[model samples]
Target: MAQSQPAQKYGPDLSVKLICPECQIPNPNVVEEFSSGDLVCGDCGLVLGDKVVDTRSEWRTFANDEGDDPSRVGAASNPLLDGVDEFETMISSRDGNSGISKELQRAAAKSSHGRSERSLMNAFRDISSMADQISLPRSIADIAKQLYKRVDEERLLRGKSTDAIIAACIFIACRQAGVPRTFKEVWGLTRVPKKVIGQCFKVLERAFGSNSPSMTPGVDTPTLNNVQSGPEDLMARYCNHLSLPVWLQSGAVDVAIAAREHGVLAGRSPITVAATCIYFSSALFGYPKSASEIGNIAGVGDSTIKSAYKILFNEKQPVLASIHDKRANVRNLPDP
Candidate 1:
């Protein structure tokens, strides 16, 4: 039997000739070879490849070169370009889908119009940066986005200023986040007037309430708690004289008494006013806080929060002792 011969290799159909830089001899099919960069002549081993070519169109591959290593000549020049072709293909396949096509077209148009796209992208980045800087929760950030959308819609639909609308959105977001930020917070965020915030608050409240009627306001979801007023405002309003310490003590006692009194007035059995008094006084003082910290617990700001320290601790001592003993079921009540 005769020995089998090796399979013959064929050249490209539209091969071009290239002059070797080394040998000055003509080298053909430089554009057809899958290899790129400097190429050597098959005969004299001289560099002959055309470095400048329309890479996307005039490229080829050898049998040995086909593998997952995209580094192969003409496979993709750079790692960055490796997945780009596939991505473009995927995008093209989805192009006929109305929504996807519209979005892609919009993005393409945006890219084509460089200035507006860059500016718009920068604005989005700024919004994201602002959200991160403030350390807003996802719920709060979503609320902010909703606020922005609402403001934009309101401006277009009802003819409001952009500033007013943005302020309204931020105000609504803070409130929804239970941040207790005031009109001042809105003013600080948007540089709008307090009255502007107030006006927008009314409008936004009506809009939100109309859209979601189930969201009625209550103590737990108090409108004040949503606003962000700084501690300075409440601190400025502090009139109680027994220092911060005595005031907190008196406040706690007074809050307890007030709750019990209110329960009595309502003809209910007087129970522990631990949460209620702290909550109520927290609001009145504008220091608005959670239930567990101020009332049941003892601290400086806690005491005078309920009333002026003098009234609860000095004048009405006996009444408090009685209530205290009753609360703990003590056999003997002590002096206040």
Candidate 2:
């Protein structure tokens, strides 16, 4: 069947030209005489529905209160296709861009918070105050700072308590700094609850690993002559006894010293003192004897030796040279 003819709709007059507010393009679908008042722009998507407006003539007035909304009035007055449109778009674009830029800046600021010097100083201050509050040794407090840096870099500490963090830092610093001390000794100085140091250290270790990558095995000038041996030293000596490299053997000695120092001066645990001494000796001197042998020499146990060695791996360099050399020939050693 053939389709019936449809009636024409009201539209703009053909003589009238309407421009799209958004694109500012001339409207092509405007009818010279229309049934309805609406006029749609063919070039752009702008739809003009007001019949009161002339189809053939240019419009200066707005559909609603043009002065009320600057954004809408601005767009209508200056279409996107014209120079006016460019200005309006630039303004609108700035609004969106500003919001995105603000969000990015906020994120960057948050990320940099932990890295700022202020943040580090704050952390140091907090730790120092905590040490004083708990009555931990000054050496232990200093060591704690080092450990805190390591932990912060590792991203393992998520706002843990100052007490917990201090204990962990102390334990790690003692081992690394060659300060052998016991949990009891630690408690005496820190005034923290028993085992808190060990427990928090375990958490830190599990999160950041039991060992640190930057740990060096050597003693400094001041600490070179300290013969306090810990299990770590015994372990180093044990490695040495097995014909380990000279560096390794020497490192074992440093580790032993660090462990021992931690126990005696830092941690203040006699049990750790003997154990650390034995372990370091075993590791550094190539002593093939088990922990039992070295522990016996130090008047401790095999378990203590093992535990002290475990602590030693995180120890820092103790003496740059052997104690015998430092005592005999101060000038003989190379300048650091």
Candidate 3:
């Protein structure tokens, strides 16, 4: 007679029983161990089964009050991937017995939609690379990306170069963020022609003009007056760049402000005005700087600085007189 195997313990509270056929007794004392993969009888010392399979939940939960929590199954999605959140299913080339044939995969690769998607992906990748090269913040990069998407949606890139448009978008984003980057800096980083970037910038400005509040969030929209930097805006920076004394810097700022109020800055670039202010203040304080030095610091030329200086000195005599009086008063005061 054959012996029957004892049932295994599937769980803490669940088990199975087998009758011992060799002993012809329904034995309740049965031990099923996994070390030798056998089922044996405890009372008769008989081996009833071998190579038995254990069936139970592999997930174990410690602490009777807690429930089982499984891990997430897939990778997280990215917004930069457009609308496609998951990888495209492709036919495996290594599996010869697979049901998906090679012809279908080849056809999918040659589709027009795939080509366009690839072009857009390449453009966005370039934008991100350019942004990082220029050390732009993540928020500005995201804004630039959104601007590029809008330009594409409007079909404005049909005749324009992609690199130029992306450069212009980054430039505008920097301006809106008040990052103080210049067109020359942007051009140097992107290697795009300055004229092309300017044209693209004009197009973007027209597209997101006063009516649209989309591009200039957290900042005032660009306007005719606010678009250009003022002489006062460039004064301190130019002074710092030249390493001038604090008194000279304050005097230069005063001269620039006076020039602005007297219409000396009308129809003139702020850089030239700032250079001229620094030059005039330097002369009055007996610590004069050359026009070339001032021009270099203020990003203008010597001739431009000379012309601005002539205009301010020839037209604004009272303002210079007031600055001279202030200097005299400071000189007359006793040392602290």
lDDT of 1 at 249: 35
Clashes of 3: 0
Best by lDDT: 3
lDDT of 1 at 113: 36
| lDDT against true structure, model 2 | 0.51
lDDT tens digits by residue: candidate 1, 1-336: 999999999988776556656556554433334456555566566555556443564334344555643333333332212233311222353655568877876676555435533433333334444455444555554555554554443553255454565556655666665553345434655555677667776777776643421122442333433344333223312313213334443454554555445432133212213333334434433344543354333223444333332233343345444445433322221122
lDDT of 2 by residue, 1-336 (tens): 999999979996878656566776553554322555656655554665556454554434434555532333334431111222212111122455459766655565455334444355566766767667544567666657766766666666575655667667765655555655444434555655666666677776665443443333473312213324344433543443345455545544454464444543356354554445434544344443466765554445677656655554444234323344433321221111
Per-residue CA lDDT of model 3 for 1-336, tens digit only, reads: 999999976656445457776676754566887767888987787898899776645554344455634333445544655654344465667657664567767776676546656666667777888888867777777767777877887887578888899888887776665555557657877666788899998888777655333444576545322455556666767777788888788888887777776777567766667778888777766567788888776667899878777777676566755566656622221111
> Which regions of candidate 3 are displaced past 4 Å?
1-138, 188-191, 211-227, 245-250, 285-287, 321-336
For each candidate in turn, the TM-score is 0.35, 0.29, 0.55
Each candidate: what lDDT?
Answer: 0.44, 0.51, 0.69
Name the candidate, 1 or 3, with the larger lDDT value. 3
Best by TM-score: 3
Off by over 4 Å in 2: 1-119, 126-143, 207-336
Candidate 3 matches the true fold with a TM-score of 0.55
| Poorest stretch of ten by lDDT in candidate 3 | 327-336
**Cα shift from native, residue 318, model 3 (Å):** 3.0
